[model samples]
Target: MNTSEYGKVAAHTLKLRVEGMDCGACALKIESALKRLPGVSDINVNFGTEMLALNHDAGRTSRQVIEDKIRNLGYTPRPAAAEIAIPIDTGRQEDRPWWQTRKSRLVLITAALLAVAFGVAWVAPSLSFYAYVAAALVGLVPIARRALAGAMSGTPFSIETLMSVAAAGAITIGAAEEAAVVIFLFAVGELLENVAAGRARAGIKALIGLVPRVAQIEQDGEIRQVPVEQLRVGDVAVVRPGDRVPSDGEIIEGLSELDEAPVTGESVPLSKTVGALVYAGSINGNGTLRISITKTAADNTIARIIHLVENAQASKAPTARFIDNFAAYYTPASMAAAVLIIVVPPLIFGADWETWIYRGLATLLIACPCALVISTPAAIASGLAAGARRVLLVKGGAALETLGKITAVAFDKTGTLTVGKPEVTDVAAIEGDEDDMLAKAAAVEQGSSHPLGLAIIAAARSRGLAIPQTFGGASAVPGKAVVARLRDGFVSVGSPRHASELNLLPDTLSDQVQKLEGEGKTVVIVATKDLALGLLALRDEPRPDAAAGIRDLKALGLQTIMLTGDNRRTGQAIANVLGLDVRAELLPDAKLDAIAQLKAHGPVAMVGDGINDAPALAASSVGIAMGGGTDVALETADAALLSNRVGGVAELVVLARATLSNIRQNIVIALGLKAIFLMTTLLGISSLWMAILADTGATVLVTANALRLLRVRPTTAASPGESA
Candidate 1:
């Protein structure tokens, strides 16, 4: 029975590494070849990462067929291998670096061909044609053969086909030297491009290689070497000093300083002890550790980070998408223009067909748009990869672009600009004993998730007040208060707003609420059925980095605003510390309106972390979530800081601007060279060989320029004028 008869072709998607793609045109060729297969549905080829993501019917066409099709298109496809990264200062060695791979061999062979062709032409002019042909055959044979194979398999419009046709045309016109130079130079450019592309793709691979493949696991009181994949949750692992943690887990014993640079970009090694969480790949220092694994190898923090960074590289910016769309039509139009140049000029004006036809072939060689197509993605990929290493995850090219333009950044006060942790600042009990009332309020706040509620519980516990184990439902909304059922009556503990909504607080008690609130503290009321027992005041302090970060943004001339649901005094206090424009007493929907209003002034970014911030985050020009561990924040924001560093925002802004500047430089170099060469070729002043070199040289130059972004690191000088 046929495979399809036995089983319906199961709809499936496959992600694989595609090797030997030279340019954006090569990516297009791979995509065009694979999509023609019987079962293939979608083909996405990313030249920046050299990855092909495809969706196809499994039974109708096997994976082998897809691989073979790609091979016929002059590329190689393989299943993605497991991730690996070599740790710094470790005794173990890593796999051979990218420069030592096939790319090096290609560069060497092409350089030899270039030397032979130029040497023979200068030394013996008579045999120069044959020598050039020999070099062309040697250098162009692989590309020419691939084009022939593609032609035999009914593939069309590939860069290989275009180059092969142009070379054959030149040889026919006694221009074999030009043809040989074109082939040799093209090879050189592509190899250099391969190095650049490989550098960008290596970021995640380098991250993966940081962790040890085999870890020391404690099983039944014995330490045994085991692969990390085999280690399950709850497995205790023994991590010695000068070793890396095997997975995300809590330390059950021992103490150490953990270097978390690989995971969160933290430069300082953090002190860790029992019950402290240690992430996979963090280097242990000075002391051994017995860690209880909380996540498997696949679900560890390192894996999650790698996955997000890879996804960020895959997503295209608006400019990249537009370039792709433009190139799709550009190639076909060039073919048409080539035909018109050859036939129209000779037939209508009685021009020499040989010279005009040669010009037409040269035009086709110039028209592939390889350099133009890659202009944005190359820069964007480099920027994204570098940002990932610095703890900033710009989700896509669009976000990176938007981030560069943000003139005003609206900050959510509670968890973004300030530390989310709150503490009890003051307490006033009007009717009952302050200690008894605080204890009852703390009991009602038991197991509560709110920062203010946790503060009350913590304050009571620290003062030796006994808290009951259980509590009833909240008296008002979820964030407002906590209510506990009692023998006499229910006791409710919530914000002053809850009391005002219920009309339970007396006017005299209201005065006390205002007085406490005036001191920049959040006031809460603890009440029985009729009378108020007391008022509790809590305050969340701004992060130490908050003032510095805001100062830096302001120094850069960015308009800053603090948006919060906290009352005027509380919000103003935090804003004043950061020296920001303040917007207070705004609920979730009101926050969305505030974001819209800010957008009207200029491009605006919203910095937030919470469920309520989601709507405003979506409404802003760019939504930057703090420490994207929260599901809602991760889903809503376009960018995330992996660590709880408010200063990451400033780093992201600088990086984004640098990326935009790099992108502009690449575009100028790519299009400017193309324009100059196009004019020269059309005017018959530049030979076909020169045109090809110009295209190749421009690609190399732009790529090298874009790589400059990789050097603009976080916590360093990213720009010339860093603001006074």
Candidate 2:
């Protein structure tokens, strides 16, 4: 989250939970005020998350000085909890009911005074003026105080300033009743805005609630309850049926079905066995599990996810930055227009002074920019929360916006397009029995770690063959073969080229090797110094969903290409089945070059799952790593798919497009309403209270619309060739 580094000087970052920021304008006010202080180099305030993060020189400034400055701006600040820990209590008053909040109490008091004024007006007409004045004063006091604080904090044209000026102007024009009504309506509007903002922040709270308070640790062969924070790596924990897993760990005892819906949004309960990895917050179904903790409480999967989402707000979208810049000048421009309307009509056009002043007050209320400033961040926060729920870990708004603009997708072939594990598909014998050839090959590959070697041994075991026990002196030849001493002669199990170099491959056996290689299978020759034994053909097939997932990407009008280090014939065979283009036999640097060329046409996204693929993943516009891949891939990629499904690529694109559309809708609603009310107020058809209603209604509507992104479901393209 640090924007830059200071040479030879240590800098510190301060994070605070800023309360009472009802709209984006309030966040801007805090940021503008803090920027004037010495040692404050960078500041980021997210209105949707109500989190203020800044970097400063620790030698020049302290946390108390910065917090005091925020208090002077008329907002409360509390120290934020650690980014990777579950947020239990952060000294926030958000848990209180609406009626107990400061704004709600003030609104209730103002409403009571207004009701008393109405009753007094019916009893004595002469005393009605004083009664209305009392009601207006009660509501105007808080508004005037906040307006003064904002003005001193470097924001003179805030919404509170406009509201105070309009209410005071109404009272000066002898419309005390209308002035009281306007003040009361504005208070109600502020209360409603507070409530709506809470709903938008509910997603973060839900994630924090997923972790349980207590964990059952197995110490000295007995189970005892302990706080989750006390859990550490290498500790063993017991998870009973119907209970949530306390932390991220690996199962070592019992098998169970785990419901991962709350954590990963996966609908079906996954069946897990011994040695399987389980995440925190997954529910154990119908069986107890003893798991060895792999990650501590702070480093668990759920904790990391929360940390990612909270930091995502620091990376703003281009559109949101544009709106922030535009709003800086917008408020002053509106204030100037109101002054012109009040002065020009009465001074030059011979209009009545009282009526023109009244219309000017209404225009001031109509020009408040609350709705316009909040349109972008709200939608972006909701979109990010939605993506997190589905386990599509997009880093920030910049990445999410860029994902919507991708024109093509490039996939790594080995583990991305096909199952990474190879299986023995066929075995042929030329000079000996097939069983004897497989047994010799398995003997040489007994403890080998290669995929093809393991597959050959597994085939021998499946057929119940008896491998020779006298084989010894086994060793591997890098990228060629495995050689071993079998009884009296030496035997080698390797690629056909290795066998040919030793003059052990015959023409008839060579033909079989070419035939199997042509069919997208790898052929390993089993031979001796005298003659060739046979060959074992192993293949890593495409995943069951690979074809359908590729079709979906194509349907969305994105070009799909496969990049792999496999042979040309093998890569092309898989590409043909999935209906995509292929670039085979690519090394790490070659993959990087291919990504650069693809970027020339448009933005490209690369999907890969190995350490060698790191260069190409970083070279592309957006790098997406599979969940089961190496840690290097996950760390280098901009985004990740936790479900390990190929179809998630299309889902990510669809979600990005949907979020962009939602943002556009919010902007239209915010601006269109203001345009309509501005025209009516100038024509003397709208009153002061009506203008306030329009502004308040627009802010509430825009926020509610943005929260709709939380309910968005995964969608596919409607038809083939549809533009994304």
Candidate 3:
């Protein structure tokens, strides 16, 4: 399944960790350079936050290409940096230390001073305009310094420059009070936006902070602490309980569970027996272990997540790119419309110049399109936050949007549809009683280490069947079965076909065994020397939520398909039980191909939980990996199931549908309000106060409406009846 097929246009997205962003001016400079790049449609740079978002066409540019451009623009890119800093200590002040984050304090001070002047103007009506003019002249010092600095450097505009222009224009019109009010309010909003952006950056900061500060390594059986950055490849590190793993590596010794939720978003503690791979940033839960560093910090999982998010932000969706293109011309077009509304109406209809000029100004304010600019990102941020709570980490809005449109969901059967482990499914006795059959099988297979043997032993334990203490010298006969001298006689348990080769006579249960085998269930034959005693059927249990999940998908109008490495009969049987429409059987490669085939029907999503499924998951429109499964699966999937519930896939779809609906509604409301404001402004019926109210009010409305998703609850009721 090609993700690019979901939309008509595909562009390359690159994430670059930016350095040296200290203020809005620095952010603006980087934004300008990025926008100058050939295919970049939009660039949003927050200097108070060290991040750059870019969207370009893949065919025209690559990740490295963009990094080169950023380098040329005098900024450092993430991948090529020698050392990456993990954000430590979240909720700290932005742009600088707490004392240095004085933007808000300065703005408040300036506003208070201006308020005093405004009070004087109000007390003396005659001085109302002049007193505020004096205040504007006082405020112009900082604004002029900023504008002159930009002008001297060849850059013509800054936020301060814009503020000076608006202020100068206000003073010329004897609206000094209005000018002061505008500048003060603008400063306050800028300060607030800086604070909000700071808070958003904190999430990533906490994530980066996970990069271990130090490592404890063992050399010659002696342990020593070393800076994590100084650690190199092949270094043997000792990780104590409750400590974060210093680097990505494999466990060499010890066994205990580890909490990797911080990195993988899987809240459950994963068992870490010897030889299990441990990742950097995962907390060791009561386990002392040694690991050889396999990857550098740059290649670590946490670093990669940071890179993914940064790149995702830089990248633009097709819709977003289209909007940007529209805006380039749209803003100028709106300006012309406002001019025409003022000039042509007064010239042709003999309207008062004041009335028409006010009409033009109203049109200008109405045409700023703040509602359109702010709604989408705010909604996305809120939705992403809500998803993170459930442990569903959507890297960006595009993937979140794609998940909702999934019309067909294809699953990799082994670890996704069924539990990764096998267990005894059915037990039937012929001439021998059920108890005797199970006992004989367990006694003979007690020493075997095969998965089948372990399964049988587990089944016997579950049924309270005991193996003889001295089932003397049980031996596995390679190609045949397991045999041992039980108290009664030499008992054997193996495949029925293998049992036949051992000269065991078929009993009445043989027919039943054949019938069960035909249903794709594995039948293990239990026998004494002469005749077949009974049959034990074994199969992996379908996950408790698998069927319900499939049912939910079908209810949402999504076609469900199951792909497996099992045989046709086994696949068909499981698909039948789950009411799935499509079942493909074969190798992992076949599953990948099957996913590709399914995509021709519509946008396809592949779900899986094993390393083998990684490629297919990556190949799909959206890869949904079971979180509790393989690391490869989790890293490759677009979204992960935190609870590892198959039903969570359905729930995700429901969430996506809700989010999309909300976005559409938001767009409608914003656009509708903007249209009405435009008509009112053209008719000379709107005031600046009304324009501000409409613009800000529409923003608040859209924001609140988008946030409705925060209160979204998965329907307690299931999707209406639809077949999988």
Q: Which candidate's TM-score is highest?
A: 2
Write down the lDDT of every candidate, Cα atoms only: 0.78, 0.83, 0.67
lDDT accuracy of residue 370 in candidate 1:
75
What tens digits encode model 3's per-residue C-alpha lDDT throughout 162-275? Answer: 456546755765667766665565545445444544554555556677777899998788999998777788889989898999888889888878888776556679998877
Collision count of model 2:
0
Better of 2 and 3 by TM-score: 2
Best by lDDT: 2
* Candidate 1 runs further than 4 Å off: 1-9, 82-126, 148-155, 339-354, 424-516, 522-537, 601-603, 610-612, 628-636, 714-724
User: Model 3 has how many clashing residue pairs?
Assistant: 7
TM-scores of the models, in the order given: 0.81, 0.90, 0.76
| Model 2 weakest lDDT span, ten residues long | 715-724
In terms of lDDT, the poorest run of 10 residues in model 3 is: 715-724
With a 3 Å backbone cut-off (N, CA, C), the pairs that clash in candidate 1 are: 84-208, 84-209, 85-208, 85-209, 85-210, 86-209
